[model samples]
Target: MGLVDTLTKSARRSSTTSSEGATMAAGYSAERAPDGNPDDTEVLDKEEGNLVMALISQLRIGMDLTKITLPTFVLEPRSMLERITDFTAHPELIFGAGKIEDPKQRFLHVTSLILAGWHIKPKGVKKPYNPVLGEFFRCTYHYEDGSEGYYVAEQVSHHPPISAFFYVSPRNRVIITGELKPKSKFLGNSVATILEGEDRVRLLDRPEDGEYTITMPNMFARGILFGKMLLELGDFSSVRCPSTNYSCDIEFKTKGWISGGYNAVSGTVKGPGGTAGEIAGHWDQSMEYKDKGGRKQVLFDAATTKVVQKLCLPEAQQEPNESRRLWAGVTRAIKAADMEAATAEKSKIEEAQREKTRAREASGQRHQLRFFEPVGEKYMPNIGVDRQVSGAPLAKQSPDEMARTVKEWLFGEVSTSPSQSVASGTQATPLPPSASVSHFGSETATMASTASMQSLNSVAAVPVHVTAPGPPVDGPKLSIPPPHAH
Candidate 1:
């Protein structure tokens, strides 16, 4: 049977016996502002009640959230595949590596850049749709400095929901690759999504040089059961350089249950010896660094850091399985504030995926991942434990070669020969522009400034390298730069 015919038959067969209160007659959409940010108004209380009840029925204190089915209305109008671009939001910190001569200082600068990215999140706490298997997202970055970056992410596994991604900056001669496996558990009043993965950044020109291993902090969806829904990050993460045996530990502290602070983080960067330096600040606000006995100075300011806009192929140019194309109808509906259309379209995708799974099972065939390859062991100390990390290798390649590869992947090739279809031959029609769709200008959020200098009570020592004159140029207010570059 044709795709529409199969879906229509399935819908009719299940329409008569649908569960009570399980399906809403219509979906609810949140009000949004001209800048694309959600407005102060809450989603329809009635619709939210239904979803909350469904969640409460299955929610245990420590229940695994990955297994639960959430209503589509609560989802953000984007896929997890596209969300990974947040890592490259601040390319200056990443590409600045070429100028730094000291390996230790370079390590610190890069690590700071990685930690600075968490503040670039959407204003609200809406969840992104879990990408379907073989789903892919690709976008390019064209910076004001005439630098360019390429990013591509693929959902490599479905069972455990693993995502693999790769990024390259030709101007910086830097490359980043990693896999993500998010494990979510429901706390009594909140949900904790522990990011189980390790991302690595390497200087392409220095192939034989060691890579920097970056870790992700765990996230908490606070007040999930009761009270206002708030998003907070907690737990601890680290960045380690195996070759230099240097490592840094960052602790994300959650606010007190009754009264306290939020978005706070403090850490220490040390080598083989004792403490080398200390970093303290709010991840959403600002971070300050102190080298041993040196005076505290600003390292990053989330309040004013400008995020670079990502360049993406228009919806029409994207392949069928690409994230934008596959979710176009749903995204368009969400953007238009048509929650009913969004939910209906989302259901179609999910139903189709279920059918594909059944067919593959009956044929005893397994879905194979394209673009990314599974690695035997990609784990670092506190990163993903034994989880498979899959991605293409960062082979030795000239800048020209890497650029060509990325271009071919984003745009089509010139060869007239036929090739394999993209992502199981699935196709979706594009949705037309609607009045609800708003192109909101970018807005910067000011993180609460709760971190104080008195909190810097750690032991202090003199800074070894003193070549830096001021803070990074990206943020004018930040004054303490890392060691000088070559």
Candidate 2:
């Protein structure tokens, strides 16, 4: 057998083996119970009514897919693959957290929740999966009680969903692998991608309006659009960031492919994007994003896209020249691409609990992010920009000091001159007469500018008071066509 086959066999063996730790980490003992042990019965009681009501209260009109509720403390839905896995690792805890009170009520509630939330769906036209709505539930409850339960809930059969893995360790010590499926009931897609320090990805379709969007679903609020990529976006594409969601313009041709097994049709993206790729024997890849800098580090500073690739190995081809084929058998036996890896089954209750808390409590106070919602340019067609943050204090300086003052705070280029105002009586240089009229309009104007967002026609010494992106010019601006339709 080839290396991939061997690895696959080995991985399968390990999972079935008593020593692989998945079963151990699952942390449940399957002691059989007497037949019809009434003690093991579960139901959805008055207590469960709270869970159902809470779920209904959190009901959003747009999440036409499944809806669920965990405790608190999760800021992003990016780690969903790992979180869902918790089912195997901590069955008891998961069962305990349901708060069903009676075993029969618990079973009914858990089973119904799973049926309502996780039923399988084939990935067909109109794929609507929301990764952000990871309000996951479990149908299979592991309550042995010495008796066998015959009831099985409906299963959610999703068509070829995408998964991405990132061996994310500075020294490769830990691998943060993630898997995602598209939920059609929700407006999401079936794509997944992972990122490291030097990865870039692109989408298959160019936006008709020269704009790309990064979105994050709000668990308690309307899903927010992070940014539109018409302007320079790659400038901020870093692997390690405060958030995992961001979009940017990429320099590349659509319908092209990456020879090193990468997809270049979307483009050679350097920011956070989810496109596609293949992994070792057991997996493949795709790409996407979440909101930026919202407690989830991946969603903050990194680009907002994920890629899904295949996990199976490619067949080896023998060159006509055979002298170099001396170790053909050996090379085929040990290639890294052909090696299969072990997968750990997980239980994701705690994961859900943590996510809910983060969404509810982590906004405004700790992490303030800039979405691309422009107050100045909204009405205009096809203008891409970052969401102008509201109530941001002004640049804190007079017209003469506009450029110098902003540069110092934003870039740390301190003024060499003695005249600098910094909340003190430190006398600043007197404003030149010409500087008074033209200072606010200068390109060097700071966030402190008086430009008012409401009046695009109005110009002042602040960002909110500036004139609009002004009426369309008579001449056409050079722009690229939509990447998707073509």
Give per-model TM-scores.
Answer: 0.73, 0.16
Roughly what TM-score does model 2 have, to 2 decimal places? 0.16
> Model 1 reaches what TM-score against the true structure?
0.73
List residue ranges in candidate 2 displaced over 4 A.
1-262, 266-486
Write model 2 residue lDDT over 381-401, tens digit each, in one string.
011111222222222222223
Which candidate should be chosen as best, given lDDT against the real structure? 1
The residue-by-residue lDDT of candidate 1 on 304-397, one tens digit each, is 6666555455576667888988999998998898878988998888888889899999999998765666766542211111232222332444
What lDDT is obtained when candidate 1 is compared to the true structure? Answer: 0.60
Query: Where's the lowest-lDDT run of ten residues in candidate 2?
Result: 223-232
Q: Report lDDT per candidate.
A: 0.60, 0.20
Give the per-residue Cα lDDT of candidate 2 at 166.
Answer: 20
